[model samples]
Target: MRTRVLAASATGALALTALAVPAAQADGGSGDIRITKVVVDGDNKVTIGTGSAKTFSVSVTATDDSGIAGADSFTLAGPGYGFESTGKPSCKKVSATTSTCTASVKTDPRTDYLSNAMAGTWYVGVWIDANDHDYVWKDKAGSFKFQRGSALTTNASPEPVKKGKTLTVTGKLSRANWETLKYGAYSGQSVQLQYLKKGAKSYTTLKTVKSNTSGNLSTTVKATADGYYRYVFAGNSTSGAITSVSDFVDVK
Candidate 1:
């Protein structure tokens, strides 16, 4: 009698399992909306300077068995940096089941829309609403890095120096500070000093020096030949590379 009761319980469990499979399949097969591809600014990575407005182009492709038309809407949200979209997207049908949407968003760090956006790896999110169904995809357009802008300046004193005399060079390295909206000293970073002889088309590295607490650089070298001296900052992950204008010094 106990074995029969156990068999009955097993049979009831099978019946309930049979009913659950069809419901799961229905939910999985009901939707035809899918995001095929997403591209941001024609590349997977992008960089923009703070306080500067940069237009980012987003390209999205979607497909639906019901035929894409005016009833469907699409949007591309970016940076994954806690910003929301306040505008509608524009889309156009390309074929019976495929549609392509093009949209643009301006990244302005000074505005409310992106005031809290921080520099780092950020992603783009795509959403599609069609036939009373909503489908969302994040990071489909890949990721990008936003970095600070940097600048470098150099000056070689005593424009004309005797061949045996010492030539003094001074410069500064700075990078954009988002909080201050101005360029500030980027201290304790290594920068390369390069020299190009009068007839040489390429500049060769002379030495490397670290910026002081104030981002100031000063170095002296014996005058050799008439050449142009410049400082080059290779930049860090958070800043963009910069090269100072060449300062020409004549050696007599």
Candidate 2:
């Protein structure tokens, strides 16, 4: 497999990159190779946390007088991220001329090859070689996007509190760091505190708080009724917004 290292901006934008395609065989005729479908992580959306792995499945329909030997290899490439092998696909013979190939891809921020990959649209490519002849075919498989995700946690101590007593709420905020392929504290960001009555249709924001140096949160509110409390993070360009599961507090 070929390898290259590139860098991305803070916003996850990629720099210029290229892929090298082998020259076609001079005498061998091009075979009929078609990429019917391509699915990444079981869908078109290719979302990955920092330092994560994803699998891809490609369906190929090949028709030729000569028998199909199946796919030779598959590749996933995009802006911010360069060409990385999905490894050789495992093809299952459906008939003399048709087969399906499945493969997996890993993005490790620690590894130099994929350390610069940003979250965005990526293109897939496939190569096929015929068993009966020197004929080979290479074509585009499909496209998908890589997106960052945020993590949030919340806790309300002394769950059962007197109606007029102060209820303490605490939480943390973090987001995927593609450079490290891990979730790190997201500090100095605004997070909303919301509350929902036991049977209410929706939650209403009570106040907004900024995450501290360690991404920790702490605040207090008067206990008035039975309801649920949660924190919502409004994500930025590089990451997607996420909300913590509601923590219930019972008021006497």
Candidate 3:
């Protein structure tokens, strides 16, 4: 999406914070295989109302202190069941004593290929090169799984705001792309607006309102000063942070 950059001071620090499984047997030899940690960035856990092309950074780490004599190579395989993998995993050598690698993947990064894939539960599996068939490293594999929530692809544009004029900021909301949970649980969800003065040190809440049956929400944002203002639309809690801002306006 297109976003307008503003000169407003950041209200607070921004925190940028993925997949799956397989039918592979564990390596009885214990080659120090593991998934160090999983990092989910940009609305990973909560739904923003509209279907979002969430981006995640998955990191996998492997180490071998068993004195195994061989070239320790690793590979990652995800059923991808229905979701899409941005590209091949980006591998890196964290350390000789400890081998580590990381990859960046997204459920749906582009709006062009939305229907080509299904939003469902997917599996991610990691493999180590050893005595395995087809060099598949099936002998040593680890797996994890996660669900994709509902998502919205509706197009939106920044609404124009007049300087010193109070404008009700309103927009649509949708679930995550892989959302399969019953809508009843998430229906009537609310979208929060976070507002702050231009160049201010902190952000304050403007309003909190639930979406209409059509998944639309509206709230007012008062332009405190004539210079500039930016607000974000988010779901759940006061932490509703806006990922983009409206267009700048000349008060005079």
Candidate 4:
């Protein structure tokens, strides 16, 4: 009877361990240090549109054998990142051994925070200042990546996009215009589009659609808000930069 009870307890322990393994992998654990929670408050990861700027919030929690000594600070590092807050970041101390921090900043509205949302992925990290003014905090540091936006392949002439009204753009390849050079250079590759309205100070991605191998693409543009926008397409050859961009629509 004692043997059977011991066996039952062992089975229960195994079951609990099995249940925790997957979670541990997903959460990312290094030895004894573990990240318990990371909460980013926002409807969309990357918010770039035709209106006001977007705001985002980040909440972090970490746990180790000794718990967190105190979070240093947080940073939004990558292309096209902006903050409305003034001065330096303020670290929030949660407990004697643990700490938490947040990032409340306004971001561009036309972009999405996805792997393919924009040009490249952005790194958002949290750091703790153990010595108060020390630049490098090895003991308290954590980071995550957020894709800035999607690849854009657009085509526009010198025409200016009108505000309050819809602007229609049509894209087509020059006859026999596809050519290849260094990095498997060619014009038959897939393309994407991003644009901003004219007269506005900032640029926003209007739409992200595909283009045919023939280099024909089009999308309707409307500004729920007003701004000067320069349209750019993603079709540059990996080998080298081209003298002329086939996918540029200056909206003004």
The candidate that achieves the highest TM-score relative to the unseen native structure? 1
For each candidate, the alpha-carbon lDDT, in order, equals 0.64, 0.68, 0.39, 0.37
Clash number for each model: 0, 3, 22, 27
Q: Which 10 successive residues of model 4 have the least lDDT summed?
A: 176-185
Off by over 4 Å in 4: 1-39, 42-44, 79-100, 108-118, 129-252
Q: List the residue pairs that clash in candidate 1.
A: none
Ranking by lDDT: 2, 1, 3, 4
True-structure RMSD for candidate 3:
13.4
Instruction: Please write out the lDDT profile of model 4 over residues 1-252, one tens digit for every residue.
Output: 001111125345412221111111122223444444555454214422333345667666654444454453444433322211212344455665345556565553323221122222333455433323322222223333332222232344335445345656555332110111011113354333444434544455556545466445566765344333333444231111111233434434
lDDT by residue for model 2 (130-247), tens: 6766344444557765556689998987879999899889999987776666788889999999999899999999889899999998888888899999999877645567899999
By TM-score, highest first, what's the ranking?
1, 2, 3, 4
TM-score of each: 0.62, 0.58, 0.48, 0.32
Report the Cα lDDT for residue 159, model 2. Answer: 76
Q: Tens digits of per-residue lDDT for model 3 on 133-232?
A: 1122333233333332433222212334455566656555544432232222234765455555556767665556676777666666555553333334
Off by over 4 Å in 3: 1-22, 25-34, 38-58, 66-91, 102-123, 129-166, 174-187, 221-223, 227-242, 247-252
Query: Which model is ahead, 1 or 2, in terms of TM-score?
Result: 1
Among all windows of 10 consecutive residues in model 1, the one with the lowest summed lDDT is: 18-27
Report the candidate with higher TM-score, 3 versus 4: 3
**TM-score preference between candidates 2 and 4, better one:** 2
Off by over 4 Å in 1: 1-52, 58-102, 112-117, 127-136
Candidate 3's TM-score: 0.48
